[model samples]
Every structure is written in C-alpha cells, then in structure tokens.
Target chain A: MKNQTVLFRSPVPVAETATIAGPKEKEGPLHAYFHYTLEDDLLKQDSHEHAEIRLHVGVLKQLLNRAKLSPQEIDCAFAGDLLDEIIGSNFAMRELDIPFFGIYNACATFGESLILGSCMIEGGFAERVTCSVTSHFATAERQYRYPLELGCQRTPLSQWTVTGAGATLLDKNATSKIKITSGTIGKVVDYGIKDANDMGCVMAPAALSTLRTHLQDTGRTVDYYDKIFTGDLGYSGSLLLQKKASETGIILHNHEDCGNLIYNRIAQNVESGGSGACCCGLVFNGYIYDQLQKGRLKKVLLMPTGALLSKTSSLQGESIPAICHAVSVEVIE
Target chain B: MILNKEEQKVYKKEIKDVAPKTKHISTLLRAFFTGGTICCIGQGVNQVLGILLPSLTEEDRGGYTTLLMIFFTGILTAFGVYDHIGNFGGAGSIIPITGFANSIVSQAMEHKREGIIFGICSNMFAIAGPVIVMGITASVVVGIVYLFL
Candidate 1:
C-alpha cells in the first residue's frame, strides 16, 4: 500500500478539546422541587432499556444545570439508542420541552448525529442543538447481536458498548470559548470480522479514511492539534490501527490518537478493555474539558467513529464495513 | 473475595503502584457518579426536544431535527462541558452521542499522519465500527425471532 505516498497526501490539523467545568453548587439551599420520586422498584431486573433511559434522563438534567443551561433555550435535539423504537430516548425526553430529531448508526450514531447537528448551526438554521445516544449491557446485547442471558464467552478483544450516553450542546455564537469549525463523514470500509469480540480488525480501516479527510479538507498536518482521539477501538484495535496505517506509508505519534490506549479498566477488570461511545465522552468531559478550561491546551479535533453493521448482514455472512464522522472543534480564547 | 496463590502475588506487586498512563480519578465514586451526572442532560435534551420540535414540526418532516439538536450538543461539547465530565466520570460521558463526536475529531488531530487513508482515515472508525456491526445485526436477528414468536 505504500508507493512513497501519492505525493499529495494531506496534513492533519490539530487543536485542543473544548473545555467546561461543572458540579452542583454547595451554597444553595436544599433543592426546592417537591415531586421528586425516587423510584426504587426498577432495580430488581437486569439493565433494561427503560432503566438505562431513566438513569440517563436524570444525568442530563444535572449536566445541564451544571452548564447553567435551561431547556427553554435549546432549539433542537438529536438522539439514538440500541432499542428499535428509541424508547430509552423517547420516554426519557417526555418531561422536557425542546425540538427532537432521531438518528441511528448503531455505535456510529453519535457521529451521524454530529454531522447533522453541526451543519444546522453552521448553516445558520439553529442557534443550538443537543445530541445524545444510549445503551446498556442487557439491552444492547439483546438488541444488537446476542443475548447476555446466554452467558456466552467473549474474546479478549471484545469491549463493552459503554453502558452510558454523552450529550453535547452546539451553538453558533462561539461562546464557551470553543466552537465547531468543520464536520466530515467517513466512507464505509469492510474487513471480514465475524466474531463480536474482534472489533479492532473491523474498524481500523474506516478510521483511517476519515482521519485523512480532515487533513485533506483543511490542508493541515498531524502536528497542528494538541491531541487526536478516535471512538472506541480498544487496545487491539488501536494497535492494529498503528500497524495498518503504517502500511499505507504514514507514521503517527506513538499512542497519540487511538482511543484504545487512553483508558484502561486496570482499575476495573475491563476485559480486552475499553469500548463504547461513551468512552470518548467520559474522557473528553472528565480530562479534556478541564485541560481546555485551564488553558492547558488549545485547538483540538474530535472524531466520533462507528462500524456500520446490521444483524441481517452479519447473519448472512457479510463482512463488516465501518465509517466515522469527523467534526473539528477549537478553543479560541 | 480471595485471591489465588499466584494472583495474590501479582496483586501485591502492582496494587500500590501509581498508573504509568495518566493521573485522572481521585476516587471511583467520582469517576462513576460524575460521568453519570452529565448523562442526565442528554435525557433532558431528548424530552425537551420532543415537545418543542413536535409543535414546530408537521407530521413527517423532522429533517433538521438532528441539526438543531447537535448544535446545542456541540455547544456543550465545545464549552468543555461534556469533556470535563468525561475525564472525571470516565465512560459515562463517553458512551453518549456527544462523546462519539469528540472521539473521531480528537483522534484525527492526534494522529495527522501522512496517509489520510491510513494514519487518520483508517483510524477514524478505530473502535466503534465493530460494536455497531454487532449491535445492528443482533437487533435484526432478534426482530426476526420476535416475528417468528
């Protein structure tokens, strides 16, 4: 795959992840809302779809409060879930008041939504939009490709779908000292992977495609940004990413971008360790956001990635093809 | 829980050693609960959008819905709102829609290798593709089984 390059390979741009810091205010009196019902009955069963939704609904409310954002100010909503009816999201949002848009890309749902969501703001169609996706151990296993109740063994390469959801609020004013500058959609790439455990082998190719697109579109190189992070490839996938990309005549900063090497469950018995759309979310929200707010880093690129596969195709013995959505955000202040 | 003979030795060897990777979590509770707190926003956005969009939308024309929603999401993501929660909270912030967006662009800028097709492009879908493939395929099979039932 290396032909001394095509002589015109593009440079990748760089920036720091945007920043936000939030936590409940301690000085306030006890929360005045009276009707809060702590429904304890749902704890009896496995991690169901509705249970996940309920958990996520409460999480978003506090997150928004921390951000000092109110529901009335948001103009639109983009969301997805492993459930067919998107029931987790649908029911979770029943109590709030904002415009809703539904989208699906399985693991890639976040990226798909980001492309559409950012375009809305850039196109001047809306002031701000909130996007989200959800999943759970039991719900995803049952809905996606297998049933967790079966207790089948997973490979060392397998990663969890990350039983949580991440939400981002995008706006046009360039407030928050960060802004969305661009979005790139990745094309589907196929690698024959049948076992659910071996995701690294399947997704590396597509991740390569979009990373290139971002650089080519802007005529920049890898050194420009503070960090480059991919979605949930885990350890094996990230290694393969380095190996495969090297084949095409390119070398990257060791352990610079791939998501696999970032967080390890060394703390939690994470098998093969690190999977899920939320993996990146947690890292960005936890680590990257603080760094940005502190002015520790500036100019970052965030790409939400996905492997596009359906049950019919896999059962039919089809190969797995993947795609990624690349959206660039910069911290300007 | 009891550790086996060899397992006990291994645990003793590494337990107190600080992580060579990064200095992140101060406590497990902070990581778990903090990530969790942010997810509530995604849920709220969903509920809020359902009402606001339904009123503005006709029967079958919610094309710009995702766009509208993401702009708000983008703001949260951009302001470091979501990212901060992600680091302290861990996976809770990552599994959601906003985290997905942050993953790709962050990686691309991180790598920025010479071959867009290889360095950046190939890695873009680095982790997520396989999960989706598995999830979608499984959902369809379940749908089939449900139909047969």
Candidate 2:
C-alpha cells in the first residue's frame, strides 16, 4: 500500500540570526561554522551560561519574532540542541512562560520536532506549537564524536553545520493556510557500508529505504509534491540517495536534495559535502519559505534522516543505525 | 612400584592447588582503567578540536560540518577498523558514539547469519532508534516554546 497525505507548511522568512561567535584569543579553538575572528573583549567573559547557549537564544528569539509570535503564547516548548543538557534550548526557554522538553537527535532534531508539534496539534493535544533545534560546532565535536581542535583536514564527504537555528509554528487553523498532512517514520538501515570517511554510503541505503516505505505507505506518486527536502545528507549522501533510490524504482536521479543546497553557498569551506541539523534548518528558514511566498513552489515533502550513535556506544565499537521521518506540507491561497 | 632411587621414594606425590585470589580485584581494576582511558582520549580530542577550530567550537550553529567526528567515526566503525579499536580499547570504545556504531553492525551481522528477517535483518536503528525518538520529542517540546513565545 502506498501512503498519501498532505501538510500545510509555513512561508515565514527568517531574519539574520543574532550572533555567531568563535573562541577568544586566549580562550580556546574556533568553530567550523565561520572563519571570522572575534574581538577579544567580547570573548573575554565567555560568560555565565556558555556563550554557545546564549547565541542559540538569540537565533531562536529572532526566528520567533519573524514568525510573528511572542514567547508567552507558546504551550510547552519543543526544543532540541546538540548539547549535553540541551543547555542552549533548555536555558533559553527557561525565561519563557512555557515548559521545556529538551531533545537530542544529532542532526535529525529539527524534523523530529516538526512531526511532534504537528501530531500534537492534530491530536487535540495542543494548539499553536513550535518546533526548533540548535547545533554548535564545538559542543557537538566534544560530545559523542570527536574534538573541534583536531585540525584534521575534512574529506570530500564532510559537511559544515550552518551557525544557525530554525523554528516553525504549527497550528490547527484552516485559516492560517499551511496544513500538516501525514508522515511516515523510518527504521534504521545499514548497507554494510563502513568507511568513516564515507557517511553518504553508510546512511544512503537507510534514507533510500525510508523514502520508499514512506511513499509506498502513503500511496503517493513522486510527482505529488513540488519539492522533496532531506536533512543533512551532504553531497555524497545525496548522490548515493539518488543512486540507491533508482535501484528501488523511485527514479529520483535528477532532483534536488536540501543538503546539496545548504552548503552550496559556502562550497569552498566544506570538504566532501554539507550537513548539520542547521543545513536544512537554515535553508528551509532562510530560502525555502521565501520561495514559497513568491509562488515558486506550492508544496513540498520534508524528510530529515538521523544517524543514531552515542559516545558510550561509539567506544563500544558499533555501526551507525539510521532513521528518517517524512512530512508533507503545502501553501494554500 | 618402587618409591625411588632412594630407599622409599613415594611413586605418587599429591600437591594442593591454590586458586588465585586476585581475579575479582583484577576485573574491577580493568573496568575502571579501561573506562578512564576512553574518557581521556575523548576529552583530549574535544579540547584539541575546540582549540584549533575556535570559530566552529565556541558557538551554536546549524550547518553541514558540525558533525565531522560523528560522521567520520561512523565510517571507521563500518570498515571494521573501529571494531579493532573497540577490541583493544574495550570500555574506551564502549564509551563513545563509535562504540554505538560497532554494536549496531555487530548485532546486525550476528542476526544476518540467522537470515535477514529472522536474523541480522531487522531495524537498522534497532539499538539507537529509541534515543532518536526521545531526543526529537524532547526537543519539539522545548522548541515550541522557544519559537512560539
């Protein structure tokens, strides 16, 4: 059986997020998001909350304002960031009147939140929900995977996270326009690919399987949507996704994948490809919404894939298990 | 049988075996040291990467490269190279995301021998799937407030 469902997506344009910071002169190493040097005085305090968390607050606040909503109106905040205690989202949301629930999805956090917020709204669980996520270069580096200061040259398959955050508003108002239709959750898949330098290969088969199942379960054809967006698959992952999807009979050999676009603007900075929860988040908020408003696209399917692994598990010597979730969204006149 | 060259060498002699008492102690020491070693390596890497790439390290970002280490580690684990690191490092391997990768594929291969469906062929995210769900759910709840309010 094929799956068929439609969603109402927003067309809100994102503003230039608040702050992008690097380590101080005597503080520490810099991040991979930008190459700009920070003035020493600002970097001096390094501050009460980690400067990283503070920056996330600014990004979140900026997006919230753009959505034309005030923080006090939100129910519980559905926030996730790539930090230990989810300090960025957790702390930032603390000042708000709503409750907080911190999440961790590596890069899949954004999609995960959207699905949840949509479900809650659709289920009568809540109204006017928001989904947001943040990832920092240094915080993520030090956690489950590796260090930021490694100074190691990135491979052609590597990606850089956009130093940004993305948040979306989901409501049940038919008048508001965008609708949340249906979704298909993915299971982890491994194609026996095992080169750390080649994530696209490792995760490609998983993304392919999920997309096929998602389409099949919904009983929908490929032509149903204006665009099909993915999480942080980067260049190799996107190419591999196309190759694998072709074998499955989906024939997506010529379409655009979001990860390919997020880093397109900063191609020279990355190695193999571009990815990060922010890659899709940035492009979606920064570009996709504006295009939709301009009538360039009417509908799109958003799918963000996640590779699940933990520091304890990595040390235990395990292979990555991948998952993806699909959401269909449309703009109504 | 005659005892020995000397008038009465016993043909058979009995000796009492003494079991080593350090077994438990060794086990605990191994666990503690192995765990410590893995943490040290991760901390070192974190310090170095954060130091070298100050721009990438100090702030929150949503981009492609924030995950080089996670992505790279996933690849190494798939290649069987990371498995070796696990075997040698033991708890050190188990303490990081690379260890999680090793476990998933190892279990997948073990079940694969049973046949794809009944065996290694189950959810690719069998082990880590829940974490993804919960992580996303938690974030959604928090993000709703951050964005809406």
Query: Model 1: per-residue lDDT, tens digit, A1-333?
Result: 011111112111111222111111011111121112232413343436556676557555655665577888778878776676778778778877877887766666766666677767655687767766655554665555442312123445566655545566666553477555566776776554555556655666677777776777776676777776677766656666666567665565633432443334344434444555544554454455556667776766666567666666777886666767666656654
User: Which docking class does model 1 fall in?
Assistant: incorrect
Q: Which of the numbered candidates is closest to the native, going by highest TM-score?
A: 2
B1-149: candidate 1 lDDT, tens digit per residue: 12345754542333223112333455456656754664565556556777766665532333344454446545655454544555455555555554565555444433343357776687655445676788999999999999989
Superposed Cα deviation of residue B18, candidate 2 (Å): 61
| TM-score for candidate 2, residues paired by index | 0.59
Q: Which 10-residue window of candidate 1 chain A scores lowest in summed lDDT? A: A22-31
Native-referenced Cα lDDT, model 2: 0.56
**How far is A190's C-alpha from truth in model 1 (Å)?**
1.6
Native-to-model Cα distance after best TM-score fit, residue A119 in candidate 1, in Å: 1.4
Q: Fnat per model, in the order given?
A: 0.00, 0.00
Error of 2 at B31 (Å): 39
Name the runs in model 1 displaced over 4 angstroms. A1-47, A254-267, B1-149
lDDT of 2 by residue, A1-333 (tens): 133232323332122222233332112221232213244312333432365566566665654575566776666567777666678788877666666667766667777777777666656667667677655554554454433322123444555554556666665553544555666656666443333445544555566676777777776777888888877677667766776577667877335655666544243445444555655565565466656656787777777777666666555666556667776666766
